[model samples]
Target: MKFVIYKDKLVESVQNVSKAVSSRTTIPILVGIKVVATDEGVIFTGSDSDISIESSVEKHENDQINVEVIQTGKIVLHARFFSEIVKKLPDKQVEIEVTDNFHTIVRSGKAEFNLIGLDAEEFPRLPEIEEGLSFQISNDLLKTIIRQTVFAVSTAESRPILTGVNWVIEKDLLTCIATDSHRLALRKAPISINPNKSFNVVIPGKSLTELNKLLDDNQEPVEVVFMENQIVFKTKNLLLFSRLLEGNYPDTSRLIPDESKTELTLQTKEFLQAIDRASLLAREGKHNIVKLSTLTNNTVEISSTSPEIGKAVEELQLERVEGEDLKISFSAKYMLDALKSLEEQELTISFTGAMRPFILHSINDQSQIQLILPIRTY
Candidate 1:
């Protein structure tokens, strides 16, 4: 393909599409990016078997030429090398031309390089997903939901389903849940537009993590299209496709207790800081466990002890403490992760018992819930 394009726009598009490129792919063509120049614009595509990304650079936007097409053609160049070349190009414009036998030349400023390109026909076609179930959500809100839950997905492959975040949409509300058996995160938000049918799907945490990075923190709406096995996320100039994980996500509703034996309300920041300090000592222990115990006069004691290191004890004043007296031990790392996901002035933590899982929720927001199982310290 022969085209002249703005350097910054091309760089951004290349960087985005490169996220789907797999370094260990058995298919040699998958290591390269496919570029197609047409009358409309230039399209760049990158894909492994699991995920694919396509980004377009229009010929002209707002009466300014973004791309000047010299000829309509297609070629594939090594993704890694091409991306590096584009980034280091000395000029604001880049000219790319493919000649006979797929020999490509890239030129910018005083630098020019000849690269052996592959036939674009060898690249796998992107999944053709017919628009079936679709919805729109604000980009910023989607990023928030991912950040709150994706961290809790299991990194191990023992239970493959736990490696993905579960998404369920009913009526006008969307709920996202992630858990690694030790800790769980759940967040719910109201959907601005609802589809005709409910959707229950498991999306790999890795995919969501990558997609989250591509999304900008803006109020613009992102369109989502759902098919049988693939999900598509689309913006103005970008299209992202990810294969859904196959398997029924375990039902986690029953894991949360109906009632609590002990309930405590405290400033979220104070509690987080106390746990942060206590974890310094707990790090020397076997499991990094921290103990929390209710004290008299609406206060709680956070403490950790390590025989090899030292002990840390801090008293945090609570806004309210009720129900039964309690002492619970849990992983300080897990507690810190759960607490950091929340942005609230105050939070309420409820303990079912010393052994059962406890839940943390914002005092003002009931849409999110974090649960952590206690660790036994003997």
Candidate 2:
């Protein structure tokens, strides 16, 4: 493969595709990046079985030349070494050439490196997805959905299915639900495409997190293709192929309580601060449990007691309180994560009781909700 490319553009493409390169892959060739230079552009692909990322550096765009392909060919280069060398290149242009025997040379300025390249034909070919189940979503909205829900997925391997976020689509609504059994996050948004199509899938949390980092927040719409066992996220100059998690995601509808015994509207920032202070003491208790009790005059007390450590108590005045007075205990970490993920300034908290899970939602927006199961610290 022979290509002379702008160093800056080459570095960007290399770094983007390197996200999927894994050092522990069973396939030897999977440890390296497959580079293919064609007349139109230079494509870099990296994969580690579960996920694959492909990034492209076009020859030119908008009257600006990015790369010149001298001899169209393909080769696999060590991802770690290639990425590092590209980043530290001393010149504005990079020249790469791969001989017929798979010998490679990279040059820029006065520095030149010789590498033994692998035959690209040996690299695993990505599945040819002919399925027609595809949809288009705004890049920003998709990123928001992943950010708001992926955090709540279980990290434990005990329940493998819980390690992924459950995505359900009905008509034009797309709902994402994630939980570790201790805390749950739910978000909903409108899907303008494939309104008549309906399907449920469990997307690995780690995949979503990586894809979110690679995706850019642009006004353009990205195409999402769903296959029998794979999901593809395609954006301009980038593509992410992720395997779908097998097994059924538990139905979470029954977990949320229909009625609440207590409801309170409070300033999100103030309540979060109070909880933060209480968590300092709560952490000493191992459980990181913080207690919230209703007080007089539309006020609530946030407190934590560590037995070995002293207690922390803070009062937060609420905008409104209704239903009944209540006291609840929950994990400080979970509480903080749920609050930070929300975009609302004012939140309405509903408590069923000290034992049942409590729910938080924006006063104006009901589409997104966070649920934290209370701790038994009576």
For model 2, the local distance difference test gives: 0.91
Residue 361 error, candidate 2, Å = 0.5
List pairs with backbone clashes in candidate 2: none
How do the predictions measure up, each by TM-score? 0.97, 0.98
Give the poorly placed runs of model 1, Cα more than 4 Å off. Answer: 192-195
Against the true structure, whose lDDT is highest?
A: 1
- The lDDT per prediction is 0.93, 0.91
**Which 10-residue span in candidate 1 carries the lowest summed lDDT?**
190-199
In model 2, which runs have C-alpha deviations exceeding 4 angstroms?
none
Worst 10 residues of 2 by lDDT: 190-199
Task: State each candidate's clash count.
Answer: 0, 0
